[model samples]
Target: MSLTKEQTQHLYHKLLDMKKELSGEKKETESMTEEVGELSNGVDNHMADHGTLVTDRMTDQTVREIDRELLEEVNHALQKMKDGTYGVCEKTGQDIPYERLKAVPYARMTVEAQADMEDELETDAPSFEREFHEQVKDLSNKETVDQKSSQTYEILDREQDSK
Candidate 1:
């Protein structure tokens, strides 16, 4: 079902409110990212504590990245609202359910489309558990090689001693 005039107005206001909040948060994150400094690039004189600067830069970059992504979503939603296509699924051109919109106002697809995408992601990528187990196996193989190398070294040492 399509949204009524009242519902559309309501959602528009909600989107604006969310956009304002996200923009403010994005500004804060950007300032923090700037303060994180250019330790790697040698732009800032962080010679006193290079380690702490690197750690802080990594953490700030992560936060800034999150904020930038959210800001992009919020901006896209605002543009869709301006284009009179808000609350409509971009994939199927169907009116997205209000419940889903309420949960994620910036969503571009209907619940079914989103579920299909998630299923694809699950099938296309190796799970974290599987990757972790594979890494563990590799580490164990390295350990076994190390043990054999140590044994070979000991055997050579014994031969030299007997000579």
Candidate 2:
């Protein structure tokens, strides 16, 4: 079933509120240089300190990008509302449940369709489990070699002591 007028209005307000909040947050975001102040210009700082600064800048950039993406999603949802397509799954052309809409006012697809899409993406992605197992196997082999080297060193020390 389609959403009632009152329900749509309620969701519209929710989306507007979310958009306002995200917009305000985006505006408040500061550049890493501004946030770090003169500390970034200090030549007396250690290499680790410089590395941390770089990492912090990268993290900040990532967060800003994520916020930008979410703001775009919120804008898209607002546009969909105007287009009279809100609360309908974009993928299946079916009515999205009101409860789901209430929980995630910006959702574009039904839960099932979203899950199916995620599964499809996962199928296309590389196997994380396989990569992890290979890393573990390599570490185990390195450990064994280190242990053997340590034993040989001990044996040589013992022979030197006897001499």
Candidate 3:
């Protein structure tokens, strides 16, 4: 299934809104960084001033990261729209429900797939750590399989057995 003209227009508007928001955030981050740099170059500040500076810098970093990620997502969605593949799940290759897309215009995964992925990522105490470990484990498993496959005689023997 594909998005109708109305739906596409709605998504376009949403994309515009997101772009505006991201632009504003980028400006704010830049301004904050400039202020921080100027303050750092100035004479010794009070404890409160230093604390506020640290907090502002941290917030700026987080906002910039979020803006960057959102911009990438919006770009991907725009590309999909151009290719006539918008509203489709990247993982499942199925049309994502209209409501879901409306709610999250930058979504790349279907609801089910997103939930499953989230659950998998959150199964451990530290979700990011768990996700990293899982990725490493997958790479290791692939390497082991490739090593075994490099033994051509063993592979041929296995193939003959299967036949």
Q: Arrange candidates by TM-score, highest first: which order? A: 2, 3, 1
- Candidate with top TM-score is 2
Off by over 4 Å in 2: 25-37, 40-44, 127-163
- The worst-scoring run of ten residues by lDDT in candidate 2 lies at 133-142
Which scores higher on TM-score, 2 or 3? Answer: 2
In terms of TM-score, which candidate is stronger, 1 or 3? 3
Candidate 3 clash pair list: none
Q: Estimate each model's TM-score.
A: 0.57, 0.68, 0.64
Clashes of each: 0, 0, 0
TM-score result, candidate 2:
0.68
- lDDT tens per residue, model 2, 32-86: 6674665656677676775787776765675566667778989999999999888
Worst 10 residues of 3 by lDDT: 133-142
Ranking by lDDT: 2, 3, 1
Q: What shift in Å separates residue 20 of candidate 3 from its native position after superposition? A: 3.3
**Top-lDDT structure, candidate number:** 2
